[model samples]
Target: MAAGPNEPKSRYLQYLEVVTGSLEEKRRYRQYKARVKRLPENYRTAVEALERYLMHFGPADGAGAMSMYEDLADLFEQSVADGTPIRDIFGADPVEFVEAFMANYPAGQYRARERNRFTSAIQRAAGEDTGQDGTDR
Candidate 1:
């Protein structure tokens, strides 16, 4: 069969693979959300309230949990400077507020893994599976 104007049939297959992989990732996040839903009433209330005033100032990195810890720390400082009202912000105590909120925000470990969810997809699309020889990025 003749290839299309945009690319070969192989490219389409790679696109579909990446898309399906992403969908599976969404399901994982859904499970995580359900668990979060089960948190204690007071904690849930606080998370909900703080989430309503969400803001993400630093780079998400979106490719592994520890990769963005530095970025997450920066966001915390920015959050405080933006007058996020620590008392009303995080559900944790004042002593643990900084570390607690930094860990809870979308900048958490789960979120970090979620960010890297697409790296393999893009790698596969670019034919990088075999020692990343054809990978562009």
Candidate 2:
């Protein structure tokens, strides 16, 4: 079993928890949905649309995904309270907005090991030797 979020664990154990799923994560998800439901209709619709996109393009790790969702809910809830327009929240480009938002959660997509593999593969295909640090040698 994985340790609770408050408990310290090895990275490998954390990875396992993400892959296997956790009850706490499920509970947090329920709460997040409920919070979204409480938003104004327009905000709810906008949040749902962003959520649909996030399901496909956001974090891969369960904890990271949940944290992103929780924060997203918080942001929208606060926005609704502040009477901020949806366009103002995400700006002109939703994709850019999401990408920028996801940047804060580095465990999400194109993780470090995967990024290294991708870079190394490209270097090999180009007949170049990449240093362990990923620089072209």
TM of each candidate vs. truth: 0.32, 0.75
Q: What TM-score does candidate 1 reach?
A: 0.32
Candidate 1 global CA lDDT score: 0.47
* Candidate 1: C-alpha RMSD after superposition: 15.5
lDDT of 1 by residue, 47-133 (tens): 444433332432242333223333333444455457565456544564355445445535555445655556756767777764544
**How many clashes (backbone N, Cα, C below 3 Å) per candidate?**
1, 0
Local accuracy of candidate 2 as per-residue lDDT tens digits, 10-40 = 7886677678666577779999999999999
At residue 43, give the lDDT of candidate 1.
47
Model 1 lDDT-worst window of ten: 58-67
**Shift of residue 45 alpha carbon in model 2, Å:** 1.0
Best by TM-score: 2
lDDT (Cα atoms) of all candidates against the true structure: 0.47, 0.83
- Candidate 2 error regions (>4 Å): 1-20, 109-112, 133-137
